[model samples]
Target: MPTLEVNFLGYRIKSPILVASGPASHDVKQIPIAQEMGAGGVVLKTVVSDKFDYMRYWPRPRYKLIDWDKKMNGKSQYFTLYSYEQAYSGSIEDYFKFVKISKSTSNIMIIGSAFADEPKDWIYLAKGIEEAGADAIELDISSPHKPGTMQFETHFIQAIKSVVENVKIPVLVKLAPGPDVLHQAKVCKELGADAVTLCNRLRGLEIDVESQKPILHGYYAGVGGPWAKYYNFKHVSEVYNEVGITISATSGVLNWIDALKYIMLGATTVQVLSAIIVNGWETIRQINEGILNFMIEKGIEDLEKIRGVAARNLVEPDLIVRWSGEKKSGPRNVFDDW
Candidate 1:
């Protein structure tokens, strides 16, 4: 029988489908549930430094499912998960306790996540997470909801470097999905980061046209949906080919197919959040079973065999073959003039 196991950050995890660090993973109670449901690992909810303690308290109605009524083939699988939630909603000490209890209760790999503005705080949080027995640490410097004026070059670069130098456990840096992903991924590799989570949610605003105002907290919120996987896929592919670093894909994973797409495009692990929150925890088991079934159908024994296959085969834009258009046709397609 084929297995879903894969090695990430020098640790063998049961599956590549990790529960992303969001509402599903913010509480210690969710850890055992994730493990029981067949998650490879879980990036614990990000603990923020006291400098951004305001993120701890969320609005009364922070989540809104946009385009929920729109459906295709009788399924509403596409929708934007708009929310204003940030940080672990707990004290830093409480976060350490949460990680410790999670590690004790579940055998699943626990990757601690944290956000801070200062390199010293990053080092301090990483050390505390390591002491709490986390398998790895992910620096969440790319959160769409991050406050203040912290730039990657000035703030996050030093934070990543400091944390990597200080932490004994593997360190993963999470970056935003933007044009600079390739450059940032290379920087992470040079800084000795064990892995890079390709892309976090984007900062977006939804409008309540009826009221002529923004929706959900009346401010720009972290937004992601099934459509997000495509850009993240591109990020993973580019980072894999150019930077050659371990990639943990996050954002827009709605099902096993989405997870498999990330794996094929060079992500060693795929972190999922919106799907679980929109669907249920059973989505974890479903994703694992789906991958196994696919492997059996294809007679593939290991994930490594297919990892980065799609990325390696990416056709350069200059080499793309286009129709000569010697034979003209009516407006059947826009490429008739090509």
Candidate 2:
């Protein structure tokens, strides 16, 4: 059988599929469920600093699913999710407890995630998570809904560097998807981040034509769906080609094929969230099985064989070999003459 085991940041994991740091990992019970469902690991929901007020945005969280068919039937697959949500509401102490419990109860890796306003707070949480026995720390600096709390680019790099300096465990920076992603990943790698999650949701707005209002709480919210997978693949491949850092590919992975695309683009692991929210936990098992079957059929024995193979072949458009002699016998479009 092909081995799915991966050595990520000096730690071995049974599989490359990880439950992303979101609603699926928000509760302690959910962590174990993901483990039982055949996930390789779970990134706990982002825990904020003690001074951060959770109650202010706790009244009523909003989320909506937009389907192409408009009927919203089970058979229809494509969807766009619009959500207005914030960081984890629980206290840091409680988050520590959750990490400890997950570690004791499951063999799968447990990654503690955190985000805070101050650099000192980032260090404090990273230390606490390390002491709590988390396998790694995922620094969440990419939530699109929470803009005010996000640090400036320079400050973000400084915070990551400080956390990496203070923690003995591996630190992974979760970055937002944008033109600056490649630069951000390069900075994190230079500052000693062991790995980087390629992306989080993009900020977007949807308007209701008749009501003249926004679909999600009248504010721009985090947007994601199957359509975003193309962008995810493009960015992940580009980052791998340029920065050459270990990547935990996140956002827009909805199936095993999507996961495979990430691995082929040099990601050490693939994180899933929107798929689980749309489908169910069984999606994890199905994806794992699909990968295993595909490997068996392809005569491949290890993930390393395919990792970054496509990226190695990527070349600039101008460098592509082209046929100098033209004028084939095929019919041409009217625009070709113009």
Point to the candidate with the largest lDDT. Answer: 1
Per-residue alpha-carbon lDDT of model 1 for 1-338, expressed as tens digits?
Answer: 88899999988999999999989999888999999999999999999989889989999699999998899887777898899998889999999999999999999999999998888888889999999999999999898988647778889889998998898899999998885999999999999999999899999998977999998688899989998888888999999999989999998998899999999999999999998998899999999999999999999999999999999999999888655656455655757438
**lDDT for residue 276 in candidate 1, whole number 0-100:** 93
User: Alpha-carbon error at 79 in model 1, in Å?
Assistant: 0.6
List TM-scores for all candidates, in order: 0.95, 0.92
* C-alpha lDDT of all candidate models, in order: 0.91, 0.86
What does candidate 2's lDDT look like per residue over 84-186, in tens digits?
7777767788889989998998999999998876789999999999999999999988888665545547468778988999999999999888868888888
What is the lDDT, from 0 to 100, of the residue 283 in candidate 1? Answer: 93
Candidate 2 residue 266 C-alpha distance from true site, Å: 0.8
Clashing pairs in 1: none
